[model samples]
Target chain A: MRVVLVAGTTATAKIPEISAAGADPTLVGHTPSADAEIIEYGDTVRSPVTPVSPTGCPTPAAITRAVRELTGFDVLTVDAGLAKPTAAPTIDVGARPGRDIREPEPVPTAPGAFEAARRMGLALPEDELVIGETVPGGTTTALAVFRALGETFPVSSSLPSNPTSLKEDVVAEALESAGLSPGDAAHKPKLATRYVGDPVLPVVAGLTVGALESGSDVTLGGGTQLLAASALARHAGAAGDLTLATTSYLADDVPELESAAAELDVDLVVTDPGFETTPLDRYAAGEAKEGAGMGGALMLADRMGVVDDVEAATLDVLSRLDPQAVDGVEDGP
Target chain B: MRVVLVAGTTATAKIPEISAAGADPTLVGHTPSADAEIIEYGDTVRSPVTPVSPTGCPTPAAITRAVRELTGFDVLTVDAGLAKPTAAPTIDVGARPGRDIREPEPVPTAPGAFEAARRMGLALPEDELVIGETVPGGTTTALAVFRALGETFPVSSSLPSNPTSLKEDVVAEALESAGLSPGDAAHKPKLATRYVGDPVLPVVAGLTVGALESGSDVTLGGGTQLLAASALARHAGAAGDLTLATTSYLADDVPELESAAAELDVDLVVTDPGFETTPLDRYAAGEAKEGAGMGGALMLADRMGVVDDVEAATLDVLSRLDPQAVDGVEDGP
Candidate 1:
């Protein structure tokens, strides 16, 4: 089976760590590597997705375009966007349907990605189709997505470095701004995500639904990815191969991720040398903790036995800026 | 509010990282410096605890000693240890006492640690105890502990580093050995821990009870520690100040930790990293992902904003290898 690692900013950061984890470098790419091919989706812009308010969700069209450009796989975009001004329900109902609106729109990203897969004679039938994401402030979006889907858990921003109250304050502010109060409602998966959430969650949820419908073994990459995947699984009422790939940093950043996984009924896999590995030299020296998503993904890829020679792969990718070079490299497992 | 950092072997490995995180070297010794104070708890000569079975329950004495040494506070041991092995129950009961019973006993190592705090006139009229633990294979133990506590969720090892099948096999084997079938019973906290469990959990449960009885503010250090704390809060029928200190890694390691915190009926404070910091490294490299008790405590101290320098506090404790030096250091906030 030809493995397609959907590279994002987060995954790209982990190129070196992924290589160290034993993955074939030929199959990975951040910008453009001399090894594995790079998939550059037109819509996949590296914008400052952080500091996003609950007012807007990501442009679905852009996401669709990006998926098409990167994977060349048939992408389905579910219309799972939340209402701009979310309403806080006063009454509590156990697992009520549509209690939290903002149902996802059933739209697929460009059919190009999927069509390209077909054109390349790639057989995805019954094969594992791993889906990962890179949504800054994704956890907040996850909280909103779950809330809209009827989950009641309090979702908040986590301090990426130390998992301290400073991070919790950001999460709490986001949640409050979104009209969700911690510990007020009985936390369910869908409800939590919808009330205080982000855009990528619905995207992942839609993708998970599509993957399951196709009967493909799916691995959801990152903690936010898994949260969306788990919510989708619960909503669809089906169970198949769905695994969560994340770094140890999430364990501390949002201790609630594990419980969310349990509620969503999914499996979890911890990526190695997560936040801990990024030499604290900067943060300990009063430098702000930097390089979280990328560092974590790289570390995760390495720990999962996915790649070898993390630094080399990272350096290789960093050294090259050509997309074609990324596509033509033959580093294999 | 004096800041006292507890040092462990893992911290020694991350000295440069710790130093980089703003710790002052001059303050890290038995003697208190201008900014902070230090407490050196050398790694005990306790035998290395391993996961005997997939159940991953640690020896009670080992966990107790570690906790006792780490936190020089009162020890509260739960009386749920089984005298002999019992077969897993086949039926599920929701929230019934004695339905899950495989809890372990708490063992105290430093008899004077708790008393010394009182002698030093540090006892608060309000309980000011903070609980921490050092149990190997704690996440696995958490799964068992949850099961033993009657949590019906399908608990698996938080080992993404290994093959998916291998983790499943271990979880399945452990369940089988315990004579319990997956999903056979409604998952509860106590039952889960008992059947597929570890010792740190019950000890944590006891600590929660201790905190409640003492009416003190409690912080559960580490992901597993938080998990146990949440479970204890749920089962013990107490509501007080209970905080969780963990790393971002745990959020990725297992989402269940997040889920459990949400289930908590008490005040929940999860100290994660602030979003300002980008590219947060997961856990520092070369250390076990599970042994984060001391690190979490340090972060918690930092988050309180009471300590001027975490690095200095840690070093001050490290420098005070001699017990006499520890006594001579002037305590500072």
Candidate 2:
């Protein structure tokens, strides 16, 4: 099956204090996203000066890259709001980084961003499009987008121990600054995103709308960020083919996601990467749940009957990411 | 031929007092460009409040729109930097309106714009592309781009009166603000565009590069603006089938265009548009000389063997624009 994987990075990822998206804070300085792209291009993402994040265990890019290798899908990287230039050739959206959500205009170019995203969406092949993103503090911004879109629910993060309270506090302040109440975001998604959402949200929303409007099957790849986009798409009166494909990690997150999917009438395609018994056991243990289009990429693999290859590659990638973890695991059949 | 017409409007057009783009200042305010799109869509451009510029006689949109009707070419409008949203379904590049060139960073998002335009260019059908534009005040910004690109040459304006002195003044101030000398622009096209060029230049250049790289014959429609784009494409290492298509209106304003074309080793495709003895006499009279991708649209019509239809339609559109001028001309054969 022909599929296009879209990756976008946003600065909101850096603000989440204990983001499990990287091995450490220093590795979080745009390296993870950049490394993710390099890995997807089948290149060793190692730089002497840059501390590359281990893709296998904590970040979704490594897993997504493995999925690409297993599934052999076409990938396109988009710099929706990357603070730094990436290592690979990326379709730069030319959007600025989102300011701290506390500001009233975190993404001042939100409307224009939709236009850019729509253009990208229109440019794609007329096949099912799997849209993914790799913003470091994406979950926080996802939560903000969700809340801004009037979804009053908590979201999962890269941290094994989700910082639900901190995220809630951040979203509250952002909503307040935007002069929005609980249900206000649904009415003006563009304005809400401009005031509080990260750069990727509006873009993803636009991509979804553009693809759907043009009659293509679209799977929003990620967890709540896509959910926010799904909400925006529905709010924008989009009546196209759309599904939310994610990992079982998010399916287990349940509650908010289930209600959101039901409300939006979006089909769900969740996959179990079977990382529990492998070296990448942390994902089963609930660390680094989803990013870099991992969920959708894995779903495509599962659909193509290459889930076993995906699982093996995930372990191999994890081995490269964390050599010490290799000693801890037994060989698989 | 399946062709796409990319039109970008810049706020810079509003600055020129006597633009060759329109007969009056009020007509210049986005109407000329918008009318071009409307005519291309095969509709009358009459809005009492909007002061629609006569596309047939003055700007090329009327002429190009006529060509589209005769040949049924696929048209895609691009909003590279429109001051206002267009009436049609445009492939919005999500670019901001360009600030006056006097600013140090007039088109700040130029590099990102290349990425956007390149994506649009790459998405088009694998056929010869006749890309056109309809930005008002595009000439002054074109002059700035040419000068910034290190070319010591003059550019044509939409006004028959040729506001060369005024354009030179604006460009001088812009170049000074950008801290650039002659020949600096060739080395730094993006930087030069950012400092002084309008939003359309980089986009068109990117579109040209994208189409050329993808192994397609590309004809940059319009006059000096496209010349500036050609220079940027060459500087960016575009080694592909490229040609510059414009009207005799611009060819008559030759010298600088000829030198620039010769320097770029680009072929020139100049169509007389036969406005001399036609009801579009004012165009021959040099009132509103070129704009709205009229020149390229005419060339494409000529290439397709429909120049007569284009001319007849130009007169028809002109009559709709200014009925008083219709009484002065004989009926078409």
Candidate 3:
């Protein structure tokens, strides 16, 4: 499967007055979630992290690691916009992190991003494209995009407990500050993204359009952020079949996502990694359920007939990585 | 050989008052020869070109084509800084093209470039690295870098006829403008690149240093531009063995290159494509003799025991691409 992993950041994450309710407090504090994911993706087991939880949570990079080990597919990371530099070889789309949704025009690189994505599409190999994303504070922007598209969907959050109320309040405040209501989103799909969305939204929409034009099946990966991309693609008159894939956690958490996908004419594909059976506490707790292309990667592994193999591989990796568990057992005796 | 091909542009190329006597007038007119080289390297024939000459001249990309076709090695193109977007998947270093050499700082990205290159190094495969570059007006900047390193070597030019005098004049004016003379270039190598060089130089130096530190044998590719990199790598106290490789065209054209290599303690390897045997007018005319990692690609192909195969493949490609030559024979019948 051809994969396009888009990464970006929202300065909304840095809003001092905004709720510290989106991403994991630890990763978001040190670096943008995109950078943290990328760093983990590159150096799988021993990546640097400031663990807020006593036992560090399993990074979604585990899924990427599984895909690499089982299928040997390279993950192409796209920097739609980011505040920090990625260690991976990233495709820079000339974008910057969106500062405040209240500013009205947040993603300044929206038009250029669309063109870059279209150009990227013209270069991809002939295969169904699995497009995914990793962006902190994406859900709020996704909510804005959804409302603009007239979908009253409850978006999922990176946090274990969905911060739906907090996200709604922030989006509401941003729209009011920008002098835009949900109805103003009418025909201008791009306008919503420019006013309230993160840098990755318009660019991913462009990628979807470009891939569809190239006659490739497209999969919008991740949760509400991808749903936002689906809405933009539909409004852009995308012709090819489009599917939205996510983790069971995101699908199960975001209550209205099913109807939103139906309204956008996107087929839904959800992967159940059965992290419930795993020894990893984070996946069980739903702390970092899906981002950095984890859901799509799992789906691709399943298609490659190595879903079981990938799961085992991920377990082996995480087992080796969690020093506290190994040390505790060794020292106890 | 694992190859890292770095490409960039200098605004110095667009200086109307500056002699258009550096790069091939034909290829540089249409595209950054670097981008053109990347396209040709990816696809051996039928790559885009604007035919300024009735039959286009042979590009250094021919060397890259020969190596890839013969040895099946991968080419990694690094966008240190570029004026135009490349069709290939480039590792962007987040650099802007130099505005003017007369400005105190020509390449503002030098410090950041060094860091980026080092990071790139950390990510590269643990293998011998073949580092090559393609930058328009690179030789003049090479002269500047060399001068900053306190070397008085006359650099090579891409023009069929070497415009050493004009380049010397330009370098002199630039050095004077930057308020720097040869002696001030002592221990700080990055200083020279910042004052007068283009964006690609420092990054390549960092790549060289990183590869060396990784215990990989490194080969600096192309002509004077690489010599400048060698100077930086040396000053940076590079530990690994380095060999500067280029075409006989560059080695023969530049008088002081041999001594410069000796001073920098880099072993020099030169390849002869033997264009004299071919009926192609441009090859015989010696236009665009070396750049785009051509000479190093040739060396790698030779090491793979396919130099003759690559030469034959190149002739076949050039013959198929040159329309007038094909048309002349077809019309004669």
What TM-score, over all chains together, does every model reach? 0.30, 0.51, 0.77
- lDDT for each residue of candidate 3 in B60-154, tens digit (9 for 90 to 100): 66557657666766556777776655545466566667756867788988878877787677656547788888777787888888887787777
Q: What is the DockQ of the complex in model 2?
A: 0.03
Per-prediction DockQ comes to 0.01, 0.03, 0.18
Give the CAPRI class of candidate 2: incorrect
Model 1 alpha-carbon miss at residue B326, Å: 22
List model 2 lDDT by residue over A153-186, tens digit each.
5677766677888888888888888788776777
Residue-wise lDDT of candidate 2 within B218-312, one digit each (tens)?
Answer: 88877887888888888888888788888887888765677678878888888887767766666666544566667777787887898877778
lDDT of 1 by residue, B202-247 (tens): 4455445555556666666555545654664566455666766664
CAPRI classification of candidate 3: incorrect
For each candidate in the order shown, give its overall lDDT on alpha carbons: 0.34, 0.67, 0.68
Chain A TM-score from candidate 3 = 0.86
Name the 10 consecutive residues with the lowest summed lDDT in model 3 chain A: A44-53
* Cα lDDT of model 1 by residue, A5-114, tens digit: 32121121122221111123322222211111122222112211211112111111221222232323322111122111101001001111112112231112212222
Q: Which stretches in model 2 have alpha-carbon errors above 4 Å?
A: A1-11, A16-18, A44-58, A316-333, B1-333
Error of 1 at A162 (Å): 61
